[model samples]
Structure formats: C-alpha cells, structure tokens
Target chain A: MAKSNKPIVWSLFAGGGMIAAFVLPAMIFITGLAVPMGLLLENALAYDRMLALVGNPIGKLVLFGVIFLSLWHAAHRLRMTLHDLGIRSGRVAMLACYGVAGLASIAAAVVLLSI
Target chain B: MGEVMDRRPYVREMPKSWWLGQRRYTFYMVRELTCLFIGAYALVILVGLFRLSQGPVAYGAFVDALQGPFAIAFHLLALVFALFHTVTWFGLTPKAMPLRLGEKTVPGTAIIVAHYAVWFVVSATLLLVARA
Candidate 1:
C-alpha cells in the first residue's frame, strides 16, 4: 500500500484549529472591533506601530505561523465541507482548496520577509 | 454457494440535504462553515500585511478602508463566526485528547475547563499587550 499524506495535512489542520480556537477570537475582536471602533488605544494598529511589530523577527514568526497554519486548517476543513455539500470530485476539490492555501502561505512568507 | 451469490448487500444512499433535517446536523454544518470566515479573515490580515510592507500610506489606506460600513459589517460577522469556532473547538478538546493520570482518566469537564482557562489567559494577555 502507498503511504498516505493525510497525517501531514491533519497535523496542520489540528495545529491551526488550536490557534484559531485559542487566539483568533481575541485577535478578531482587537483588530476588527476594538481598534476600528475606538475601544482600544487610538493608534493600536497605526502604521508605525504595526510596521514595528512586523519588523521584529519574533513578531514575523508569530504572524507567519498564525497565517500559515490557519490557512491550511481552513483549507482542509473547507475541502471536507465541500464534499459534504455533495461536490464528489475529490481530486478537483483537493487541488482547488489546497492550492489557494499553498499560494497564500507563500505570499505571507514573502510579505513578512520583505517587511 | 448459489444462495450466497443471489444475496446483495443493502446500501443506503444519503440525500445531499440530509444535514438540513436535524438541528444537530445543521449546527455541525454551521461549525464547519466557520472555516469560510476564518479563511476570509486570514486573507484580510494578509492583505493588510502586504499593504504594510508597501509603505505607510498604503497601510494607512488599508486601515482606513477597514472602518467603512461594509468592512465593519464583514468583521462583525467574522467575529461571530470566530467566536463560534472557539467555543466549539474548546468543547471538542477533551474528546480529541483525553487526559490520563496514572491509569485514571481525567474527567472530560476538567479537561474542558483547563482549555478555557488557558484560552482566557492567552486572550487577556494578547489584548493587554496589544493595547500597550
């Protein structure tokens, strides 16, 4: 029998799920609601502060992990969700879902590095 | 051998709309659909990051765009979906990784509580640190 690559995808899915569960709510609340609505400091996400955050090596790593893993996790889940919705073309679904995620991950890496 | 050959196994076909018939199934679908919002929110952040890399003006424009009515609405919905994902994920943690303490399995409730505790601490830290 051929080796299955399910584990690799599943690991990323699980890790991403963990991050999404533990950290994403606060992130969304902060960036989406609080900052935009003036609930937090006036310049919580100002360009200079944000640039500084992304400029730091540790910040870059953290942002990369969150963006990369979350994308993979969502990709895998979306693939399954598509299947559940009766799109039975497995190969096509897999390619489309994972393809977007792969491209986005590369984009994230590049953008982070350039910063 | 002849009788065995004549017997066909029964196979039940699941209707595509099966999930719609039950509340639990619908909830499950909603839970799965959280990925859409999560994926979208990730892309939004990615765009913001890209803009930040471009320059201050570009990043400032991106931030300005986020405050518009449509952007605010999208984020509001995304926030709801994200919170839903968090709640469901924490609920399933115990089943995914049961704790065993020297052959005695820890109660699932305890495991769930621990997850919530960690989640709260992490969230508070992020909010506070980001605010500073």
Candidate 2:
C-alpha cells in the first residue's frame, strides 16, 4: 500500500467538519442571537461569567479545538473548491489556503492560552 | 492558419459564472461558499478568545458588538450558511466511508440519522455545560 500523509489531514478535516456541523449552529444562535437579542438575560454572558468560562482549562481546550479544526476543515475544503472552479494551480492554492489555516491555528492557540 | 486553428474542436473552458446557470451547479457553489462562512465563524470565535485575553474591558466590548445590529445580522446569515454546511456534510458521509454492518452495507439514510442523533447529544452537552 502506498501510504500518504494526506489521510491524516483529511481525517482532521472530516472530524472538524462534523464538529462544526453539530455544534456551531447552536453556539451561534445562543451567543450571537439569543443572548444578544434579550431572549436570554444580559448577564447570561456577563463579563465575569464569560471570563470564568474561558478561564477553565477544559473550556480553553474546547474553544481551541473548535477554532483549530474548523479552520483546517475550511482550508482543505476551499482548496478542493478552487480546483472545482478550475483554479489550475493546486500547489499555490494548497499553500495559500493551508498557510492561512496554519497561521490562524497558531493565533487561536496563543489567544486561548493567554486567556 | 486561422481557418485551420478554428477548425479544431474548441474546448470551451468553464466560465467563472458557470455555476449560476444550473441548479446543481448553483448548489455546488453554495456549498463551497458555506466553507467560507465556517472559516469566518472560526475567526469570530478566535477574536473572542483574543479579546478575553486582553481583559474584561475588551471582552465586554466584543460581547457588546455581538449584540449590535450588524453583528446579529451577520450571525443570522451565518446560521443559515452553517445549517447548509451541516446537511451537505452529513449527506456525503456515507459516500466518504461507506460503512458496513455485518454482511450488509449500512444505508446512507441510517448514516445521516446517526449523525443527527449524535449532533443532538452534543448540542445537549454544550447546553448543559453552559448552564453549569
């Protein structure tokens, strides 16, 4: 069998896509709409409470995972999508798309850690 | 020379707006665009993390901005895009792995149902965690 590292990254993209599909919509609804729209109380996201949430090690891990995986998923997906659009430059598209994901993953880590 | 070149079967390259013409092609384009929404969504969360690290003052403002009309509108649009992403992704899962059950291949409908079931569980977990 000819082994390829592509599987590893593809696995990440698949997992990330699953996580994003399952979790992100609700998260957006709650934080972006429900809480903000006053369907939920204001202090539902009070500064201290949110700080405490991010302060938790588990919380940090989940946040970081969500950010990292989702970005990588989008990066790989966009790379393939460009090909579908006949970009005709796989190497450059791969580098550009994955490069942003790599940098953003680092940034997400740094920010999550600092919190 | 011109006549000879013109005589050759001209392969028309796909137009940039080629997706707009067909329902299937438009859906494909929408699916691709949803990837960007997911990317943008991740950026939004990362920004929240950065703001939190900066301290309560910055984080408060981020939450404030999220409440604002523009942010709400963006998220509302994002919600639609995210749902599109979810459905399309799960729809393809069976093809991606083609799961088997004993001697029989698992049905794609079963795969999608399993995905939704797990999805509900995770969503419940997140809700519980938030409440806790």
Candidate 3:
C-alpha cells in the first residue's frame, strides 16, 4: 500500500484548530470590535504601533503561524463539510480546498517577510 | 465462495437532511459551519497585513474599511462564531487528550477548567498588550 499523506494535513488541521480555539476569539474581539468601536485605545492599531509589532521577529512568527495554520485548518474542515453536503468528488474538493490554503499561506509568508 | 460472492450486500441510504434529524446533529453541523467565519476572518487579517506592508496610507484605509457597517456586522457575527468554536473546542479537549497524573488519570472537569483558566489569562494578556 502507498503511504498516505493524511498525517501531514491532519497535523496542520489540528494545530490550526487549537490556535483558532484559543486565541481567535480574543483576537477577533480585539481587532474587530474593541479597537474599531473605541473600546481599546483610540490608536490601538495605529500604523506606527502595528508596524512596530510586525517589525519584531517574534511578532512576525506568531502572525505567520496563526494565519498559516488557521487557513489550513479551515481548508481541511471545509473539504470535509463539502463531502458531508454530498459533494463526493474527493480529488477535486481536496485540490480546491488545500489549493486555496496553500496559496493563502504563501501570500501570508510573503507579506510578513516584506513587512 | 462463488455463491456468496454473487449475493449483494444491502446498503443504507442516508437522507439529504440527515443532519437536521437530531438536535445534536444540527449542532454539529453548526459547529462545522463556524469554519467559514474563521476562514473569512483569517483572510481579512491577511488582507490587513498586506495593506500594512503597502504603507501607512494603505493600512489606514484598511482600518477605515473595517469600521464600515458591513464590516461591523460581519465582525459581530464572526465574533459570536469564534466564541462558539472556543467553547466547543475546550469542551472536546478533555476527550481528545486525557491528562495523566502519575498513577491516576486527571478528571475531565479539571482538564476543562485548566483550559479555561489558560484561555482567560491569554485573552487578558492580549487585551492589555493591544491597549498598551
């Protein structure tokens, strides 16, 4: 039997799920609601501060990991969801789902590096 | 063996709306659906990152766009979904990874409470840092 690549994708999916579960709520609340609604400092996400955050190596790594893993996690979940919804074209679904995640991960890496 | 091979096995057909048949099934579907919001929110952050790299003007515009009515509504919905994911994920963690304390296995409730405590600390730290 050929080796299955399931473990690699599953690891990414699980890691992403872990990150999404733990930090995503607070991250969303902070960036989406609090900052925009003036619940945080008026300049909480000001350009300078944000630039400084992204400029730091550790910050870049964290952002990259969060974005990368979360995308993969969503991609895998969506693929399974599509199957549950009766879209049984497994190969096509796998390509479309993982393809999007792959491209987005590259985009995130490129953007982070440029910053 | 040949006679046995000639016989076809019966297969059960699942209805299209199977998930809707049970409350737990429906909840499970909703839980799965949260990924859409999570994926979307991540993409939004990705876009913001790209804009930030573009410079202050671009980043400011991105931030401005986030405050619009549609953006606000989406974020509000995403926030709720994210919270749901967090709750459900924490609840499942005990089952996913049972902790061992030497000779005895730790109680599931203890594991869940520990997760919540860590989540609280992490969220508080993020808020403080962002506001600082």
Candidate 1: where are CA atoms >4 Å away? B1-10
lDDT of 2 at B42: 92
Consecutive 10-residue window with the lowest summed lDDT within model 2 chain A: A38-47
Docking class of 1: high
The lowest-lDDT stretch of 10 consecutive residues in candidate 1 chain B is B1-10
- Candidate 1 residues A55-97, lDDT tens each? 9999999999999998999999999999999999999999999
Q: Could you give the DockQ of candidate 3?
A: 0.80
Model 1, position B55: C-alpha lDDT score: 96
Please rank every candidate by lDDT, starting with the best: 1, 3, 2
lDDT of 2 by residue, A1-115 (tens): 9788999889988888988999998887777787788774556677788788778999889888998999999999999989888797889999999999999999988877777
Chain A TM-score from candidate 1 = 0.96
Better candidate by DockQ, 2 or 3 = 3
TM-score, model 3, chain B versus true chain B: 0.90
Residue pairs with backbone atoms closer than 3 Å in model 2 (clashes): none
Tell me the tens digit of each residue's lDDT in model 3 across A1-115: 9999899989999899989988999889888888888884577789999999999999999999999999999999999998998889999999998898899989999999999
Candidates' chain A TM-scores: 0.96, 0.91, 0.95
User: On residues B1-132, what C-alpha lDDT tens digit does candidate 3 reach at each position?
Assistant: 445556689999998788999999899999998899889999999999999999989999999988898988999999999999888888999899999989999999999999899999998898888878
Cα-based RMSD of the predictions, in order?
2.2, 4.0, 2.8
